[model samples]
Target: MAKILVVDDELGIRVSLWRALEFSGHKVTLAKDGEEGDRLFRENPTDLVITDLVMPKKEGLEFMSGLLVDFPDLKILVISGGGVKASSKDIELLLDTAQTRGAVKTFAKPFELHEILACVRDLLAADAD
Candidate 1:
C-alpha cells in the first residue's frame, strides 16, 4: 500500500477522500489547506498527492511548485471546484497551468470517485515499475 496525502479546504471533500483512500488500503493523511498540506508533506512524504487547486493560505499551484523544486519526480493529482470567485475560463487556465507545472492529472470538481481511484492505482502501479 502507498502513503497518500489528500489536501483540500472543504471538510466533506477531505473526509470523503480520506475515507475512500483508506478503504482502498492505502495509508492516507488529510490537510485542510496548502499551508498545512505543505507541512504534512515535508514531515512525511507520500507516494502521491491529491489536492484542490483553490484554497486559503496557499493554493495548490504554489504548494505544488514548492514541492516540485525539491522533489522533482513527485506525483501530483490536482482537483478544483473552480473556486467561488473564479470563472470557468479561469479555472481552466489554472488547471492548464497546473499541468504545465507537473501535475500528473487534473480533475474538475464533481469528478467521479472511481476515476480518482483508478488514476491513483495506475500511478502507483507505474511507480512500482
Candidate 2:
C-alpha cells in the first residue's frame, strides 16, 4: 500500500476520503489547507497527494508547482468542487492548470470514491515499477 496525503478544507470530505483510503489499505494523512499539506509532505514525503483546488493559505496550483520543483516524480491528484459561484469553465481552467503544473489526474467534486482509489492504485503501481 502507498502512503497518501489528502488536502482539503472540508471536514466531511476529509473524513470520508480518510475512511475510504484507510479501508483500502493505504496509509493516509489529512491536511486542512495547502500550507499544512506542504508541511506534512515535506516532513513525511508520502507516495501520493490528493489535493483540493480552492483552499486558503496557498491554493492547489501553487502547492503543486512547489512540489513538482522539489520532487518532480511526485504523484498528485487535483480535485475541486470550485467556489459557490464558480462556473464549469472555471473549474476546467483550474484543473487544467493543475495538470500543466504536474497533477497526474483531476476530478471534480462528488467524484466516485472507487475512481479515486483506482487512480491511486495505478499511480502507486507505476511508481513501484
Candidate 3:
C-alpha cells in the first residue's frame, strides 16, 4: 500500500477521495488547502499526491512546484474544478501547466473515482519498479 495525500479545498471532494483511496488499501491523508498539504507532506513524505489546481491558500501549482523542487521525482496527480463555470479550455490550460510544473497526470473535477484509483495504482506500481 502507498501513502497518498489528497489536497483540495472542498470538504466533499477530500472526504470522497479519502474514502476511495483508503478502500483501495492505501494510506490516505487529507488537506483542506495547498498550505496544509505542503506542511503535511513535509512532516511525512508520501508516495503520491493528488491535488486540486485552484485553492484558498497557496494554490496547487505553487504547492506542487515547491515539493518538486525538493523531490524532483515525486508523483503528483492534479485535479481542478476551476471556476464554477470554467470553460474546458481553461481547465486544460490549468492541468497542462501542472504537468509543466511537474505533476505526472491531471484530471478535471467530476472525474471518475475508478479512473483516479486506477491511475493511482498505476503510478505507485511504476514507482515500485
Candidate 4:
C-alpha cells in the first residue's frame, strides 16, 4: 500500500477520496486547502499527492510547484472542476499548466474513480521501478 495525500476545498470530495483511497488499502491523509496540504506533506511525506486546482489558499499549481521544488521526485496528480466562472478552455489551460509545472497526471473533475485508482497504481508502480 502507498501513502497518499488528498487536498481539496470541498468537504465532500475530500471525504470521499479519503475513504476510497483508504478502502483501497493505501494510507490516506486529507487536507482542506493547499497551505494545509503543504504542511502535511512537510510533516509526513507521502508516496503520492492528489490535489484540486482551484482553492482558497495557495492554489494547486503553486502548491505543486513548491512540492516539486523541494521534492523533485514526488508524484502528484492534479484534479479540477475549474472555477465557478471559468470556461472549459480555461480549465484545460490550467490542467496543462499543472502538467508543465510537475504534476505527473491531471484529471478534470467528475473523472471516474476507477480511472484515478488505475493511474495511481501505475504511477506508484513506475515509482517503484
Give the Cα lDDT of each candidate: 0.94, 0.91, 0.92, 0.93
Cα misplacement distance, residue 22 of candidate 3 (Å): 0.5
Q: Residues 1-129, candidate 4: write the lDDT tens digits.
A: 999999999999898888888998999999999999999999999999999999987899889999999999899999998989888899999999999898999999878888898999899989888
Candidate 3 residue 71 C-alpha distance from true site, Å:
0.9
Question: lDDT value for candidate 2?
Answer: 0.91
lDDT of 1 by residue, 8-60 (tens): 99999988898899999999999999999999999999989999988999999
TM-score of each: 0.97, 0.96, 0.97, 0.97
**Evaluated with lDDT, which candidate comes out highest?**
1
Q: Which consecutive 10 residues in model 2 have the weakest lDDT in total?
A: 81-90
Clash list (residue pairs), candidate 1? none
Q: Write the per-residue lDDT of candidate 3 for residues 7-97, one digit (tens) a residue.
A: 9999999999999999999999999999999999999999999999889879999999999999998999999978587898999999889
Every candidate's CA RMSD: 0.8, 0.8, 0.8, 0.8
To one decimal, what is the Cα RMSD in angstroms of model 4 from the true structure? 0.8
| lDDT for residue 71 in candidate 1, whole number 0-100 | 95
Mind giving the per-residue lDDT tens digits that candidate 2 earns over 1-129?
A: 889999999999899999999999999999999999999999999999999989999888888889889999888998898867889899888888888888999999878999998888888888888
Q: How does candidate 1 fare on TM-score? A: 0.97
lDDT of 1 at 62: 97
Which stretches of model 2 miss by more than 4 angstroms?
Answer: none
Model 2 TM: 0.96
